[model samples]
Structure formats: structure tokens, C-alpha cells
Target: MPDQIADPSDLRGDCAQCFGLCCVALPFARSTDFALDKPAGKPCPNLRGDHRCGIHADLREKGFTGCTVYDCFGAGQKVSQVTFGGQDWRTGTKEHARQMLDVFPVVRQLHELLWYLNEALGLSAARPVHADLRRALERTERLTRQTPQELAALDVAAHRQEVNVLLLRTSELARAGVAGKGGKGGKGGGKDRRGADLIGARLKGADLRGASLRGAYLIGADLTGADLRGADLIGADLRGADLTDADLTGAFFLTQPQLTAARGSAGTKLPESVTRPVHWTAGS
Candidate 1:
């Protein structure tokens, strides 16, 4: 597989292809993430008759910032088009709507795995296990096509665990190539800040090659020009962080949501699964 994936980000989302599933299928409580309280199966008042959010253009200004941060990884369209045969819940039978709600989350998990698997395939250093990655990718894709009944009963956590093992191996192989070589990483290699509280830390230009930052709190950190190639950023909180020229060529499990929340520039090098936010070019 090539380092650059032509359309892997398509797995991210295309709301036009969906049936407003997120607005109706999921529940939200009043909190920092959500401004209103809504129960499951209840449609958001902002949802138009055509299934588009009426406040999409000014979601954050209207206190719907949570909507902007949410990504279903293309599950909405899969459930709306494929699983439900292009049916919209507003017009579908009550039982059909119920089934659609149940199946949507399952598809989301499957698509997320697909995103990670595609990214792992893009790591040239992990070429030795490309065959295994291909097989895992096929399995995940197949599961996404299962019927609603099958999905309702699927052990998605177990499936995710299996895929995670391969991803960890892929991350190790890719990060190893940039581990040592100098600076904060020293001669032995990169630093390990896994699950550390790095919020507001001054790590600008730090050598983080091959570092495990899984579950790290990096909110508001200054990481400009950092070398983060092949780092494990599975659950790192990047809201308000600066990555002006950081190199993240092979970082594992770094989602588009994380990047959109951070500050970066055209100089920032990213892996295949992430897309640079349009606002990043506004010279903030």
C-alpha cells in the first residue's frame, strides 16, 4: 500500500449521504459538549425536513459545538443507505426506526476500525505484516455489512481488540525508524509520555518520535515543530494545542476530530487518515 491513500478519508463522513441519524439516534445531556438535553429517538429541533441541520453554518455560535466535533466515521450513510435500504426514519415504520438506531453505533465502530486499518496499511515500515493487515481489513469490512440482527449481537469490543494488536505492531515498526538520532529523545530513543498530563506544557520542538501518548492530556500544549513521527496518539486530547510544523508521518489512531481541535499549519506533516482543517490556514 502506498503512503498516501487516495480516498481513505471518505470513511470519515459525508452528511449528505446520511439520514440525520446522529440528530435522532443518539441522546445528549446538557453539558460543555452539548447545550441542550435530548433523549434518544427524539430529533433535534434544528433538523430540517430535508435531514440537514438548520444551524450547520453557525453551529458553534448557536451552542451546537458538540455537533461539529462528532464524527460517526461514515456509519450514518451505511445505516441509511445500505442497512436500511435508503430509508429515512421519519418516513419508516417505528420498528424500522428502532432497528436503524440499534445498528448505527455498530457500523460506527466498524468504520472506525476501517479507518485505522487503512492508516496502518499506509505505514511503509510495517510492510512485513501487510498481509495480516489486509486480512484484518477484510474481516472488519465484512462485519460492517452484517444484518441489523447480527450487528445487535456482535461482540464489537472483541473485534476491536484483535485489530488493535496489529495496529500496535504497525506503530512500533514505523516509530522505530525515527526513535533515536538526537535531542530530547536522546541516543537511546524517544520519550514515553503515555497517559501523562501534558496540558499546557512547553514541548515545542520536542523529539517525540515513537512516543506512546495514548490517553495523554495535551490540551493547550505548545508542540510547534515537534517530531512526533509514529507516536501513539490513540486518545490524546489535542484541543487548542499547536502543531505548526510537527511531523506526524506515521502516528497511529490519530483521528480527524483531534486535529480539527488543534492549531496547525500547512507546514504540519500528517499521516494519511487525517485531513488538515480549513480554518488552520486563516493565520491564527
Candidate 2:
């Protein structure tokens, strides 16, 4: 398995292969993440009559960068072709429409797992379980190709539990490699935070021990309950990020500017020189 996240640029997006499922099947709130509030089973306003984003060329201008970041990873095509036999929601009965909508989210989860599994397989450090990871990846890919009925009826939680066991092994292998060689990460030229936008990232319960997060943008990220023990957070932007219930015991080199940029609750533990954010006190 690979020691890092696979570059997401490798993913190909072809909505023609999909049934416009993401635009119809997913729910979103009117927040910074989404431009509008949409219910499940309803097509987004940006979705064109021809099953494409009407604002595709100007998503950033219209504040739909979150939509741009989302990648279905070909599961949309597999579900539309293999499961429903190329049937679109426009051609389906009410029951079929409901079924397709339900199955869409399931296939999306499977695709996300595929992403993680693919990443795990590229790590030379996970040699002990490289064979297992590859096998699991192939198996998951096959499951992703199942029909709508199979996908809709799948016990995804159980599959996720099974996959998580393998991911744990992968994490252990990679983290062990990081801990070796005196805790220096393999990336040459040290930590590169250039143009890194980590808004709303799930860093909760993350083991960021000894990590160099220099100049990284961590705005609105959830670091609640994170283990930041011994991390180097110099020059990182932490604006609007939540550190409530986080444990920063023994963390190192966290700058004042970084601390000032984040939000926290009273329960958040802190480094000696920095106090909690003002919002934390106001909210408390």
C-alpha cells in the first residue's frame, strides 16, 4: 500500500457515462460547501436538461468548488450500465427511481473505498499486506460493478468494517515506516504547503504526531478529538477550524499566528504561549 493519498487527478469524470446520479441523488445544504440547498432525489439547478452542469465552465465563479472536488470514480457508469442496464431515472417507474436513488449513495461509498484501496496498494512500505491489499482492491472493484439491486441491498456497513481492517493494517505499515529513520517523512525538501486547501477536512482522531504542516490551509477543518501530540504546525492557516475536544499535549513549534486563526472550545487543550480563540470563550 502507498504511504500517501493517491493523486486525485488520476480520476476521470464523464457524466455521459453516468445517469446524472450525483446531481439528483445526493443532498446538500446551503453552506460554504454548496451553493444551494437540495433534497435527495432532486436534480441540482446546475444540472442541465442534457444531464450536465450548466455552470461547468464557471463553477468557481459561482462558488461550487465543492462540486468540482467530488469525484464519483466511474461508479456512476457501472451503476447506470451494469445495474440498471443503461436505464436513466427519466425512464424508470417510481419504485425504480427510488431504488436507483438509494443505490447511487451505496455505489458512491464503494467508489470512495476503491479510492482508499488504490492508495493503499501503491505503498512499498505495506509489503507485508501488499498482496492482501491488491486482492481486496480487486474484490471491491468487482463489487462496485454489481447491479442496482445488489448495490441497493448491500450491507455497506459490514463491507466498510471489513475494509477498515485492511486499512488499519495499511496505516500501521505506513506509520511504522514514518516512525523509522528518526521520524522524518519521505517527502524530499520537507513539507510542501503550497496552495494546499484543507477546508472542512476530517482530521478528527488523526495521529498528527511529528508532522510538518507548514503553511498549510486548514480552514474550517474538524480537528475535534485529534491527537496533535508532538506535531510541528508552523505557518499553518487554521482559520475557522474546530479544535474542540482536541488534545494537543506535548505538541511542538505551533506558532501564535496559527493558533490565532483557529476556533476552539473551552475544553481544547493548548500550548503554553497561546490562549484559546475568542470565539471559544464567547460560545462557552
Candidate 3:
């Protein structure tokens, strides 16, 4: 099997092919992320008839920062087009709309796993488990294509657990040989900070090479100029975190959503997998 999937464009959200599912199917409470409360299955007031955000150009100015950070991992278009046969929720029956909404989240979760699996397969160091990752990816893609009823009835949590085991192994294999700056060998010399609560903590200029930061709460934390090469950032909450000038050159499992939610600058070196957030400043 090839080390990487042929194409990963399907793993990304494409709003043009979607039916505004995220705007309608997801709920949001009034907070710094959102400006108002919205119930599930209801359209956001900013949604236009064409299934585009009316405030797309000014989401941040309009107090919809959360909207800018969220990514459906291509689940929106899958549910909107493939699953529903291009059915528009606005024109569908209330029951149909509800079912679509319910299934959106389920497929979203699966697609997220697909994203991680795809990434894992691309890692040269993870070649030992590449075949398993490929199998998991194919299985996840099959699950995403299931009927809405099957999706709604799917035990996604159980599936996630199964996939996570492979991802954990992949992480171990990928990070095992990344020697830290201080001559520390093997997994960044014991910088295991998995699931740590570092909210609002100052970590500027810290060296976190090959560190395990999976499931860590880094909300509002200052990570400016940190050396994060080879770090595992799966499930890390980086909302409101400062990443100015941070060196994340070889970081793995750092999704676009997490990168977008944090603050950075043009000088912040990032891995090729994720793009630099537009909100990031031009200078360091």
C-alpha cells in the first residue's frame, strides 16, 4: 500500500457543495465564541437562502468567531449531497431535517477519524502501522457513506476508541526517535504532558519537542516562541492560545481548527499539513 492516500481534498470542508448544514444542524450558546444562542435544527440568522453565511466576510467583526474556527471535515457536503441526495433541509419535512441534523454529527465524528487516519498513513515513521491505518481509513470512509439511519444508529464512540488505539501506536512510532534539544533521547526526553491543564499558563520559549500534549487544555495559554517540533497535539484545545513565533515545524495531529482558534504571526513556523490562520498578524 502507498504511504499516503491518493487525495485528501475530500477530507476538507467545502461549503460550496454543502447545504449550510453546519449553520442549521449545530447549536451554539452565547459566549465569546458566539454572539447569540441558536437551537439545533434551526438556521443561523446569518445564513442566506443560498446556503452561504451572510457574515462570511465579517464573521469575527460580527462576533461569530466560533464559526470561523469550526471545520466539518467534509461531513457537511457528504450529508448534504451524498446521504440526502442533494435534499435541501429547508424544503424537506421537519422529520427529514431532524434526521439529517442528527446524522450530521455522527458522520462528522467519523470524518474526523478519517482525517487522523489519513495523516497517520502519510507518516514515514509510522510505516509499521500504515497498513492498519489504511484499513481503518477505508472502514471509516465506508461508515461515512452509510445510510442516514445506519449512521444515526452507529456506535461512533466505540469506533473512535478502536481507531484511537492505532493512532496512539502511530504517535509512539513517529515520536520515538525525535531527540530533544538538550541531548534527551526517546520521545523528547520524557516531556509527557498528556491531558495536562495548562490554561492561561505561560510557556513562552519552552522546548516541547516530541511532547505528548494529547487532550491537553491549553486555553488562553501563552506559547509564544515555543519549540514544538514532533509534538503530538491530538485533541488539544488551543482556543485563545497565543502561538506567536512558535516553532511547530514537525508537529503531528495539529488540526486546522485548533490552529485557527489560536493567535499567531507570520513568523510562526507550522507543519505543511495545516495552514496559517488568516487572523495571524503579518509580523512576529
Q: What is the C-alpha RMSD of each candidate to the true structure, in Å?
A: 2.9, 12.0, 1.9
Candidate 2 C-alpha error for residue 247, in Å: 25
Per-residue alpha-carbon lDDT of model 2 for 57-155, expressed as tens digits?
787579775575565766677677767888888787989889888987887777667766665666565678877777777777778777667877889
Q: Which residue segments of model 2 deviate by more than 4 Å?
A: 1-11, 180-284
Better of 1 and 3 by TM-score: 3
- TM-score-better candidate, 2 vs 3: 3
lDDT of 1 by residue, 109-168 (tens): 899888888877877778988889989988888898899899989999999999988876
Q: What TM-score should be assigned to candidate 2?
A: 0.62
The estimated TM-scores of all candidates read: 0.89, 0.62, 0.95
Q: Which numbered prediction scores highest in lDDT against the true structure?
A: 3
After superposition, the stretches of candidate 3 with alpha carbons farther than 4 Å from their true spots are 179-190
**Number of backbone-clashing residue pairs for each candidate, in the order shown:** 0, 5, 0
For model 1, give the RMSD to the true fold. 2.9
**Sequence-dependent TM-score of model 3:** 0.95
